[model samples]
Target: MASGSASLMWFRKGLRIHDNPALQYAAEGTKFLYPVFVIDPHYMEPEKNAFSLGSARAGLNRINFLLESLADLDSSLKKLGSRLLVLKGEPSEVLIRCLKEWEVEKLCFEYDTEPYYQALDFKVKNYASTAGIEVFSPVSHTLFNPTDIIQKNGGRPPLSYQSFVKLAGQPSSPLSHTLSSLPLVGDVGSCVISEVPTIKELGYVDIGQDESSPFRGGESEALKRLNEIINDKEWVATFEKPKGNPSAFLKPATTVLSPYLKFGCLSCRFFYQCLQDVYKNVKRHTSPPVSLLGQLLWRDFFYTVAFGTPNFDQMRGNRICKQIPWNDDDELLTAWRDARTGYPWIDAIMVQLRKWGWMHHLARHSVACFLTRGDLFVHWEKGRDVFERLLIDSDWAINNGNWLWLSCSSFFYQYNRIYSPISFGKKYDPNGDYIRHFLPILKDMPREYIYEPWTAPLSIQTKAKCIIGRDYPKPVVLHDSASKECRRKMAEAYALNKDLNGMVSEEDIRNLRRKLKEDPEQEAKNKRIR
Candidate 1:
């Protein structure tokens, strides 16, 4: 422990003050510490192959949410007689500059394992090592470190959720650390701490609040929500993940704590301990793979797999994923993206996702299915890319993993069991209240025709004041036929087990594409088997 030394605390995803291992360690044995956040250009600039550079890497909804989170974190730091130093540049360059100018003896940050972050952290670590600056990095982003858990499982991450839960077992007690006092550094020369950037500054328009989603980002709000949910012992004890209604727009049955978790506004370990304490008192406590506890387990499972698996974001070369020739239909994909797919059930969920920057788990399942195998048959990567931009809670590991699961490209493989773009939502929201609220064009639509307005006669549509192909675009494709063709294609691909690295050859994909245009079961059978 070096006394009277200066330390730099680089804030990344773990933005909150509580249960933060890196912050706790950095503040220790030091008289003063400076908290810093670097705004990386990588996130603010488009990649070389990006479709467009105007939006950069993130959408308006996520940008607004992130800016709010940063502001909240700065406020929390202020109450403790400190402030956040915001810097805009590449992280390695900024960190190197700070290390020399601030005359800092140590650098501390939470461990992150995403490929991009991993590479950046490596550069920073190497620089610190060469310069003889101590770096204190503790893994706190997840309940358990993915490396440790995977190593315990024979150097490979568990393939199934059940396997992962069995290996992870239970949440241990939360770390007993507190930031009762934080000492300020002597001087931060020439590092004029910038304020968190606004959406306009980041080149994005601010997306206004969604009446359906009442979430506000910050450590305070996260803790408040955590307390409320835990205190409701009845909800905690009786909580079953599957039974929660995705279409319950009035109020989501689930706690809706994911965005907080994603931004590290709340500590996963602390939340787990609190949940366990409440769960102990209840007579009927649900278990993992489908409980509130199960959600955390699912998160960890994805993280572990992502950490161990290379190219985990895509289907090619992913050992765990089953390769299939997925379609690249931009027109249909665009329709899905803009909420004009004419399937009220699918369109409503997309509206909710874009408006709120979050949606229920089953709703995610519904939309992801529609994009991949259910209707559009677009590649899962396309959906993952869209989600990465739109979701405030978008995580590299979780987002890709879930898309693969829903698409039957990996993790899950019940390709025959595709989600119905219509009845799945109707099962939960039979009266179509969810559709009416999100897609106001269908607000006056009769309950029967709400999910499938195209099926209704012109008179009924006119009476509702909404017309198919005029007000809302007609269905992108007939759900029944398209999904069936998709399933057949998936089956043929799976049977072939061919590894397609790029676009499936135009000629080969043309045959599958033709299946969408006409019934070609006999054609598909003869071509595939031969």
Candidate 2:
């Protein structure tokens, strides 16, 4: 807080200048300001295999989005007489060295709840403390700090959405930090810093001029999109999640600003304020668990749970996750991933996900259900990994949380309510236009047989030039039979869990499954008793 002290503002997820509390703190009373972003190689490394899991490999689309956001941040900083200094290497090491070499008196950054960042921050804080450098971190990425929400809920994260909403009162209003200028970075001894790296330099194939996401990434673009959505007062007032059309691709039913939010390119508080402004003008608006505001709350809800829950991403040690015996069939998973599932509806969603790096929430539900408790009986973690790599809006907390919900692994227990891959898409796009757009092989297929192309007669297949089991694929698993089997397995798991008072372990689940295989009659009798 001393005047004329040097400050280094560390930029992580909080990429925007507007309503950034940490940035404002770093700028205040500083004689020299160095706005810095670290590019740790952990996230930039190339994957050994395309489908490799448990790695930090980011898809090119997301990487490109990140680069664009950093560039935009730098541009915004430059307009205020400062620039973002992009540093490469391990974050703690680079930051500590910079602190000493530049003689920085203070270090400030946005508070992050993710365990990875938490550990990294600990190291940096320790080094800064030893060197007598001041440290300040303010929560800005999420609406409310997870720790505060947990405290309000009596030392535990509220599991249910309704419970979470009650604990999370109105979010604090966004702060205004208008600035005429910022002090320029001056006189570093030997520390190296550069502008944001090009995609090619970061080891990605240079994105071609034509190969671009329709959703451009930057704070400028985020604000423009936010304004466009907010200006439609009527739409904002009545927007509901269930009413959104999954097949409306030409113009999506929902705001597509999730990527901006995920990357902190747009401040969550700023967006919340904009939504509140719209709601004040309307007489009565849609409420939570469905409304547009509800969607944002769902995001915060996941963050709170993830922060409080141990091993939140994985099933083995995740306390909330049910130990369902998910199959380890790579072939089934590959079929689902490669868009060769033979179910046109499910495959088309996957195609959209791969190509566009975005999908409607309902579309996500359909595929996630198919891969897990609905049909293939694959693990939700597998699907979670795929989404984490592909989705432009993939957040560690939300991605895992949604996969768990859709799979009936946790949060949601209604495993019997399966999303029919065929009927789900038909309800929204009866003509199967969404399928046709993504899967051109199904374009000429008749409308009646579009959702289930294998049912088409050989003559019809020939006429359409898209033969099932030949050009396209036959249905990987019969939906009715597979879903019935999956439900039975889920019931057995749930019953066993109930008998154990929800204290079932991974080994216990495996034992039950093994017992069921060995003596079906005995297991059935035991299940009936339980």
Candidate 3:
């Protein structure tokens, strides 16, 4: 708080200059402010533990987007008379070293909810406290602090989206911090600020550009895209989440600002204010649970739940997740991961995900359902892992929450209402244009058989210049039978565990699995046995 002192503005999720509380805090009452980004090995390296199955926390696609964001942030800082100091190694050690070497007076950063990040932040804060350094940490990730919401709701989070909405009440007006100019950097004798590392330097091979994606990462791009949406008053006023067609390509039907949001390139509160401005100008707008603002609230809802709940990322020990015996078929999971499931609709969506590192929300729903309950009946954790590795916009809270919702593990339980991999895409895209765009192998197939390429007659397949089971793979699992079996298994599990509730432990799952495996009656009904 002393004037003419040095402060370090450590960047995490909040990669932007506008509406950044930590950055604003660090700049005020300081003669020198150092903007720093640490490329922590914790995330840059692949997690090789048993549960991870040797997947990197961030794949090339995400790393590429991150590097772009950092470069843009650095450019923005330089314009303001400072540059981002890029460092590598563990965050706590890096920050501690900077504190001593730079002779810093304050340490500031945006707060996050993931357990690993929370722990890392704690260590840094502890060190700062011991060293008698002023520390200022603020929440700018979500519209409202998850802790505040949980405290207001009797120390627990709302289970359902509607309940969450009612409990959340309404988002407050966004806070403003005006600045004519940022602090000028004084001579830091020997502190060499490294430039943002390239994708290869971050220990990943560059996958190159995705032509399917019309997205670019950074605060400038975020604002530009946001302005385009807000300027279209009619679109903003009439925006509907469910009605947006997922099959549309080249131009996303919805605002593709998710990557910006994930990296904190755009502030959620600022976005909310823009939405409000649009609503006031039009004087007519849709309500929550489906509206554009509703989408953001959903993000906060998941954060609140994830913050309060234990074992939120996994099924076994999660209190709310249903105890379904998900299959452990690596081969089936591999096919799903590589976009080779052989169902054209699902495969196309997967291909889009791999290439673009993003998919429309409805497209996400279709694939998640197919992977968990609709087709393969594989564990949702496997799907969650794949998303973590691939999605440029993947956040721990949102990713796990959506997987649980779609898998019928928690938040939802319409087990029998399966998304027909074939029909779902056809409804949005009657001509199978989405399928054809991604899966060119079946691009020439007739519209009727595009979603079900395996069903095309031999002559029809030959004429299309592609052959199923040769050029493209056959359907890994028949939709109808697999869905029915999944439903039956779910019904049985629900019936057996009707009275059970709250944080079913690993031991509990092990016992249940043992019983299910040993029982002859259960074996007779095993979906995989068929």
Candidate 4:
């Protein structure tokens, strides 16, 4: 911590310069400051049989967003007389090497609760300790340290939003860390520091730029969007999640700031402060679980729960997840994933997700419900994987948490209340213009037949030039019958869970699923006879 001591700041999710405590600490009173970002092969390397610009875990859209954000960060740093040093390798090994090579006396980075990052930080800290280098990691990705929330809740994460909000209280104000200038990375004896690599340089075939996306990834863009949205104080004051229109694609009902927050381009605390300012000026405003502020709190709630629970991403061995006999139907899952569900409402959302890597929250709700308890009865894990790869705003904790909720695997228990694929979208987009925009095959279809094209007569279909079962595939499953069956299955699972007093083990759940799969009809018959 001495003046003139060299320091290195490792950039992970906290890609922006503003309100970054670690970056400020690294730059303060240092003779030479090194800002570094490591491209780990774990993320960059392709998965088996996967076709994507990066790892199958991340698609081209997410990769491009990341690269753009990094490039923007580098630009911001250059304004302060420094540049981001992009290195490629395992992070711990890379950082340790940099520490020794650069003769770094102090190391600083944003603290992360993710299991992978935690393990990496442990390895790097061990090396730093032995080398007598000081290490500092400040929490900034989320509004508050998840550890603090857990501790305040008596060493457990609050399961419900109401409970979480009470425990979370008020988020601290954003830190003001203005940097007039930064110390240059001077005299690194043998360390080779490279600039940010292009999409092709990362072993991805250059899928042309993400020109179609409405979002541009960067700190600059993030701030710009925040200011523009927040300037409308009246809109911010009355914002409610349920009232938002999922079908309003051109002008989305909600602020599309999720991707920015996910990548840490926009500081959550900074956003929280902005919302608080808007609320202060208004006579009365919406509150948590629906309000704009509530959205951020919901994000924190998921983070805390994911941190507290083991296997939060998977149903098996997940303490909070309800064990259900979810079917493993590859064909059904594929049809759902590829936007071939035959329901314009469901298919259009999937298509939008593929094209733009973003969608309205309610649209997400419709597709997620359809894949799980609503119609297909596919496992939530399958849906989680698709979201992980496809969404630009995908975060590990939130994605899994939502999948569990939507699938009725955990958190939410209202399995009976299904999102009707036909009626749900009709409420928001009665004209089906949203459907026409994404699924152009049905562009000429009449409004009467838009929601249910199969209901139309042959002559009417011919007039529209879109023949159901020919131009467009028929519905994969009868929604009414499939939903009733799904609900029956869910009720049976819940009854079994209740009978077992919610103490079912992973092995027990596995056995139950196997038994159901092997002789489901016999089991039902036996129950009827009894």
Candidate 5:
């Protein structure tokens, strides 16, 4: 109601008010407060030449979760002697006009890990300063600040979790901030009384569930999930063998906390703290919850990498990993995309992503490895984009790092270590129970033959009621031959320019492809796999 009386708190990814720095700053600095959520159409808009915003399409799951979270946040604010002032459109545009109109004098918000947000933060900071509003960003989510984590040889950060874990333990104990929230604001900007839009309303459809949406989004739900995983410690024993099955349904038994962690519903700092508290109790009777915290450390590692770069979402920002001359085969790409790759494990994973908007982390590795390595140098961006669309928990740093690592351009550039999806399927899903779940077309085949239904005798195929060629697509490409061809091409390209930065140019890329087409051994192997 009065000049210099109110402060504007922008609610971005850090939706919950508890233990939030920005919210506390807003409450502490001013007599009144205004809270807002700006819908950046920037992410929702389709990409140049791409069918959709792959990241945003994948982002829809979080957006859907956020909508629910925001509603809950609003309710929480109401309980805490205030209410969230919701708004949508460009945040800077909205904030500039709101500051001037409401006579607000300070802006406080949580810092985001992505480059887009950092760039946006700069633009908004300029606007706020010119408007005489002080902007404040708090490091609330990550355990260690971004600059704190880097690797040996003074390289760009460690791309592998093992390296990060070793370095992470050496860091001085992480800082903890006291929790508080802003007192209620009065006479704020005219609050828009409406809910945030859904992914479908924002031009993407909901990832429908035959069951209730498994993810309960927001802070309370996130806390509940953390509790469930460690509640009585039953999950502790099962976690060591997290990737027992390959068909990728190996979830729930595996912690599903990533989505919450990605969106800041659960803070990595708090997650580790909680795990430590539980570990203290269970140290004698059981193994510590080390497996769970190890995964959380990865979240810390990626955010460290993401915050260091500009537009970390861009495929090339992880330059160490960009040297991969990914093959650009349209047909193979299509088969991989459609999930009809005749690899039941791969297909099952793909189908799950389409239906559930989530997949196991190991599944991501298998599929991404198969695509980047098996296909031989297809742009990792292609795979990254696809993951961004389907994975509910997709984060740019993790996706790009793993993609490039497998591609041999990342910090962990190992060329010979490649996953054979054929071998992976046989090993992880030995009985093919996971395969039978999704590719029901192959359900009638013998349990042993489910993965390769074509190998079943023709009579067996008839009893199963489908020919491999007619019913399910043939093996899109053979694994062993495809792998060898991929390696040869990569090696040939690297020969000219061993370094990815310039050594492997377009000319180098072309020569490798030509060599692969000419290699008879690789081609014959393809025939056998099919």
Candidate 6:
């Protein structure tokens, strides 16, 4: 180990320098310190992750975001007489190796919620403790820790989001957070920085146009985008509507902070701090983007739960109100995973996911519903895994919660939760603008008729210049029939524990099966035909 005095500030998902607990503590501890990022088992090879970038696959975009975030950090760190050191391996193995090159006694990094990284964290901390080194973890992922939130008369957290928001009060003595405040580096000097690789390095060929609209990285850029989004007058007033449409791309009514949030390029504190600024100080007297803050709070809430609960990435039998045996059809699952479901709206949403490693938030539900209920006889986890690998902003907590929510997991489970395929398209992409952009097969269809291409009649479907099943697959499942079948399955599954209102019991499946067997018609329907 090198003998120079250096406190290693390890960077993980939390990448920003400002208002960060790890960075703050490390800065207070040692003047001579090095920021480090381990391309370890967790970051480099997450068992599953949201993978995608524009033309850059999510795996590629993630590396790119981290690289840009690190580059920005190096610039800021140089201002602070420090530079980040990059290394690879299992975190424990790599940190042990770092001790040889630098006189490192203390390690600092943000806390995590995912089980995979948490296990790695436990190993590293134990090793550091035995080696007489100190390890510190700080909360930077969420506004309030899951432990801190008080649930109502139940171990279960609040089931509804609106209820969660009502109780999420403002933080006291709001912290000042901006990238410009970092100090200049006198001890730091010019150093070689290698460019982060694109998807090719990750062993995937690029596809389609570079749909990435030059999304910038770093805390400054995140704030810049935040300001642009929150401050736009004409658009800000009407954000809720255009936010989901494809035609409104540049003004992207949605806050495009997912990549930064994923990489922690900007702290949630900083993001919220920016909102406080816009709300309190922006002379325009705008409503402080309270509507926007609600979304960020959701981001914080998911992180809090994921971090506090182990094995949360997987489903809980108790939490989701309903779950059924999803069909095990690989071909259908693959088609959905590869963006070939053939329903133009569904395909368009998947293509955006394929092209950008992201799609608007609502699109996620629409597409997931189409897979779980519309056509594909696949398990939710199958789709969830694909989404994790491709989504640049994928967070385990949010992803799991969302998938569970959409897959008949909560109250009103499959009962009142059927998404009308036609209604959904008209509501979000009314003009078929999004479909035309991603699904070329339906490019010639009129905006009004695009949502229901199959309904256009054989003559009209042919006149629209696309042939059903040949050009685009016909609707995989009828909305009414599919919803009814899905609901029955969900109700049967919930019957597994008749005491669900109380607690679970063994052989509950047998009891549920007995109920299912009594209804022969349901048994036949239960066996999904793909």
Each candidate structure's count of clashing pairs? 0, 0, 1, 0, 11, 22
Write model 5 residue lDDT over 1-530, tens digit each, in one string: 55667888888777775567788778774678887777666654333454333333544454566677777787788877788776666777776777777787788888776766777889888888777777888777677666666534163666556666666663223336544344666664364534655555666544466522457678788888878877856455335534445454645446677777777777666777776677676744333224676666666777777566554554443344344456677767767777878877788777776556677666777788787765434667787878776666767667766666656655555566777665676776677777777778887778777777767888998998878888987787777667777777667655655554454455655665665578676566665444
Looking at model 4, which ten-residue stretch has the lowest summed lDDT? 521-530
Q: What value does the lDDT take at residue 53 in candidate 2?
A: 22
Ranking by lDDT: 2, 4, 3, 1, 5, 6
Model 6 clashes, total count: 22
C-alpha lDDT (0 to 100) for residue 341 of candidate 3: 83
RMSD in order of candidates: 4.3, 4.1, 3.1, 3.6, 3.8, 4.9
Cα lDDT over the full model 5? 0.67
lDDT at residue 464 of model 3 (Cα atoms): 97
Distance from true location, Cα of 50 in model 3, Å: 14
C-alpha TM-score for every candidate: 0.92, 0.95, 0.93, 0.94, 0.87, 0.82
For candidate 4, list the clashing residue pairs, or say none: none
Stretches off by above 4 angstroms in model 1 are 1-4, 42-55, 170-172, 200-207, 210-213, 498-530
How does candidate 5 fare on TM-score? Answer: 0.87
Cα displacement (angstroms), candidate 1, residue 78, comes to 1.3
- Compared with the true structure, all predictions reach lDDT values of 0.82, 0.87, 0.82, 0.87, 0.67, 0.63
Off by over 4 Å in 6: 1-4, 29-31, 41-58, 79-81, 150-156, 162-168, 172-214, 233-250, 281-290, 308-310, 316-321, 373-377, 411-414, 457-464, 497-530
Q: What digit string (tens of lDDT, one per residue) describes model 4 on residues 261-310?
A: 99899999999999998999989999878999999999999999999988
Candidate 2 residue spans exceeding 4 A from truth? 1-4, 52-56, 207-212, 516-530
Distance from true position, residue 35, model 6, in Å? 1.2
Give, for candidate 3, the lowest lDDT window spanning 10 residues. 521-530
Where is model 3 more than 4 Å wrong at Cα? Answer: 1-4, 45-55, 186-192, 203-206, 210-213, 502-530
Clash count (model 1, backbone only) = 0
RMSD of 6: 4.9
* Candidate 2 lDDT score at position 444: 98
